[model samples]
Target: MTDFRSRCIAPEPLAGLFCAIPHPTGVEICAATGPDFLCLDGEHAPIDRERAEEMIRAAQLHRVPVIMRVPGHLPDSIAGALDSGADGVLVPRVSTADEARAAVAATRYPPVGVRGVGPGRAAGFGYRIPDYLATANSRILLAIQAETPGALENIEEISTVEGVDVIFIGPGDLGVTLGALGPEGRPKLMAAITRITKVSRAAGKAVGMFCASPDEVQGWRELGITFFLIGNDARHLADAAGAAVARAREGF
Candidate 1:
């Protein structure tokens, strides 16, 4: 399996795409599209455990690393995704260092964390239990979303959490939280993004964020954000369909 966590921390930047459609075929399609990794959006999407597990398998078949974004920081939410063979878990709505720690703990096993011992597909269904246990602690990535104002205030502390791998910013949510939703609010949003990136980088952590377009990715990359989750499958599909419809109408 690819060590996506290590790649994220590597000298160069890493780019990835998001999959919101809750199906194995969608996972396979995204994997085939070839990003460095894929974030399975279980948080906003209606993806359940069984579908997630199947998607994980689909990703593995295509040799793509997958990180499931759980709805919350609950132990079950985190563990279930890992057990289903996801390479990592992204906990959303993390507003404090404590919540960041809890997210990390949920991804780790005993002693280091309270994560239980049901390995399932991640451990090769008991066949690779020893191998899994020996490396899971270091292998699994734990990313916490830092989108709210409170999270930005505690950004440094959250970044310094021992097991926290990535401090991913939800720009859309952050913009709403900061009351800066349009072009008029670009300055404030950029300032907040810059601050979070600088603090996170200073703490020796990788920074990630959502990029709606290539322009946003370039801007964030300049701010030292290496991990990027670019557009989702649904949006891409809609845009393509809309374009085709417009072209057909013009021809007719």
Candidate 2:
């Protein structure tokens, strides 16, 4: 009923998946399937601004929230995503407190943040945000990613960066950083995820992680990780496509 990314920021903890591969149809399909949010992949997936805007529009039209995971952790990139009307911005590989601070500052306007305020898609394409300055910071959700070894080592500090709404651990990269990406929930990796949840909760921010399966979600939830990204659109489609072909071959 409520779709963020276009109107409100961090209105709720968006429950959803990231679509690394951008096909409008796939974006539309994810919307119909009904994840609370959909993150447009620009960092790992090849995509353009035009396409990202379209997907954001699509997701909003279908009542699914959209977050854009930008390629860089730079302020300009973050401001652009915010201006593009992203419900939130998931910054990748932010291992330090400064990077986290910069991401927040760039998304909010002066007095709260140094973001340059002007009219754009974020402002209803030049017709919105009548009170953009007064309310933007309260609405914008800032997510800083922890996927590197340095990030894991400094989880407490990273989690405490002011204005950060959530701290998400990149599972694959996180495990690889810890040198154990083979299984889903290795003891060490699970502990790392737990640490993030604990630190973020103590700092008054939400903690989140993306897992390969729903089975993996419950445990993370028990660990106080509320924002659980189940999986991605491309991965699910690919797996289903392969399985369907295999079944047809078997019938043959």
Candidate 1 per-residue C-alpha lDDT over 1-252 given as tens digits, one digit per residue, 9 for 90 to 100? 567778877635877888998888988988987778899999999999999999888888889999999998789989999999999988999999999888888999989999888648888887898899899999898888888999988887888899998889999999999887899998998899889989999999989989887577887777889899889988888888999999999978
Candidate 2, residues 1-252: lDDT per residue as tens digits?
443432222324446888877777788888898787888888889877778877777887887767889998778778877787787888999988888888888888878789887787978776777766566777777777888888878878877788888788888898888886766548888787777778878887777788888788777777777776778888898889999999999978
Tell me, by lDDT, which candidate is best: 1
lDDT of 1 at 92: 92
Error of 2 at 9 (Å): 11
In model 1, which regions exceed 4 Å deviation? none
Q: Which ten residues in a row have the lowest lDDT in candidate 2?
A: 3-12
Give the clash count for each candidate.
0, 1
Q: What is the C-alpha local distance difference test score of each model?
A: 0.88, 0.78
> Ten residues in a row with the worst lDDT in model 1?
8-17
**Runs with alpha carbons beyond 4 Å of true place in candidate 2:** 1-14, 183-185
